[model samples]
Target: MNCSRVNLKNNTLYKIALGLVVAVSISACTTEPTPPVETNELPCRVAGYFKSQDRVGGFYRCVWNASINRWIQYPYDCPRGLEFSEQLQACVKP
Candidate 1:
């Protein structure tokens, strides 16, 4: 086997590994999620779904994190042309 060819193959593998490492690290880190209310607060004391107090067609979910022993709120939005129906507790066309 030619030494130069072997060196080039090793270099290509090294670059590929480095790229994968960077992609994984970036994906592992979470950015701050969007806030749902003017005060940027959610009463996550109870774990379940909650309506967004500010925006129309918006909602959020309160999930229990056993590792932290607390509730975390994740904001979501209904699909375009739909709104969250608090009465029905689901998204509906308004």
Candidate 2:
């Protein structure tokens, strides 16, 4: 009789431990994943004072010139068949 009681208690304890482990696993799988962070850096470009051109042959953009402590704009001329790419910071074929 005592042996039978001990077996029953052992089975009950095993079932309870199994139930706890399953519950923990399910909760872990259901958690939400972390989101990606955003940044202000431009793609295919470096962070510094520089110039870039637009599709038209006339428009241009210049960054702050630390040496002179001011912003300066320069006239940039793209090739007849190509335009300036701000992302690339150079003239590229359209």
Candidate 3:
């Protein structure tokens, strides 16, 4: 009988190589999203002071005032004593 032996296991080396590759791949995958660049400037000049009265937890309303030449924000509630005349188109809810 010939008494000879050969080691046929290389699990430790394989595991180390795999771990290094996984670590490198994970590090390469981390990146921050780029912010969008602003392309245009405001066209209209702010004529007067405008205030927004939107409620903390409710829908928002936008109003374009041709008189004051600026957009104003109003609360979700309907204006007092104003019978929401469908003709004026006063309030815009978004």
Candidate 4:
């Protein structure tokens, strides 16, 4: 019919601990942050495509002959696929 002071203290501690555990568990269940969405605004620089650092002749951005250009089929995507060779200053096929 009566509760002891110690019992009240233990109940409060247990509630606090349970609340913290629930918070931590919910946070842990959070989804990984989605990668920033790629947008058309992102510069389609060829060097951006070649992330490799060790290779000397890694893929470079360059424009290809309109006839041979794969993007030619998708003219809307033009320039997006245009690769540039900084050394050559000319468009090169990616």
Candidate 5:
């Protein structure tokens, strides 16, 4: 009915809208971030580097053995204070 009353109502609506936007934004980001997928299968079939299922500082080198006619998973460990990185395909400082 009055100017002050109209301003009060408008202020209340603005606050409610801002709060709603903030709540939605917070809720949207509340979900947990997914972790990086790791491969943990059996004997390697391809000749390449693969992630080790046992340790973080370890990895498996899949090599083709002509005599055995199959691939071999040679377990290897990184140097002291290093970790295996999938992106780099080598051991790196964590």
Candidate 6:
């Protein structure tokens, strides 16, 4: 009878330990997802900008330097009396 009681207690303890382990495992797997980082600024206007292509809007294609983390403009300068136009996607006399 004592042996049977011991076996029952051991079995109960083992089941409790297994239940705790399963609960912990499930909690570990249910973490909330991380939020995305926002990057609102334009890539071309940042310092250390690198031109990627020739004039698209009277401005060379450019990218913001990853280190600087700011908007950057293209390298080519617009001609006098003209300006680069985003809507026109080219340099304009206006």
- Residue 10's lDDT in candidate 3: 54
Off by over 4 Å in 2: 1-55, 58-68
- Report residue 7 deviation for candidate 5 (angstroms): 99
lDDT of each: 0.79, 0.56, 0.43, 0.46, 0.77, 0.57
lDDT per residue (tens digit) for residues 1-94 in model 2? 6998999999999999999999999998895533322322232132332333233643344455579765444454677877666577777787
List TM-score per model, in order.
0.51, 0.33, 0.27, 0.33, 0.50, 0.35
Best by lDDT: 1
Error of 4 at 8 (Å): 0.7
What's the number of clashes in each of the models?
A: 0, 0, 0, 8, 0, 10
Q: Give the TM-score comparing model 3 with the true structure, all chains together.
A: 0.27
Off by over 4 Å in 1: 1-39
Give per-residue CA lDDT, model 6, range 1-94, as digits (tens). 6999999999999999999999999999996633323333234443342322344323444445468865444355567767677666666776
Model 3, range 1-94, lDDT digits (tens) per residue? 3333222235666788999999999999998633322223232244322222233222223456789866554333345433332234443333
Query: At residue 27, what lDDT does model 3 achieve?
Result: 93
Q: Against the true structure, whose TM-score is highest?
A: 1
How many angstroms is residue 70 displaced in model 4 relative to the true structure, after the best TM-score fit?
A: 28
What is candidate 1's lDDT per residue for 1-94, written digit by digit as tens? 6999999999999999999999999989967876543336557787666677876778887877799876777788899888887678898999
Positional deviation of residue 51's Cα in model 1 after best superposition, in angstroms: 1.2
With a 3 Å backbone cut-off (N, CA, C), the pairs that clash in candidate 3 are none
Error of 6 at 78 (Å): 44
lDDT of 5 by residue, 26-84 (tens): 99889653333334546777888876777768777777879978666667778888888
lDDT of 1: 0.79
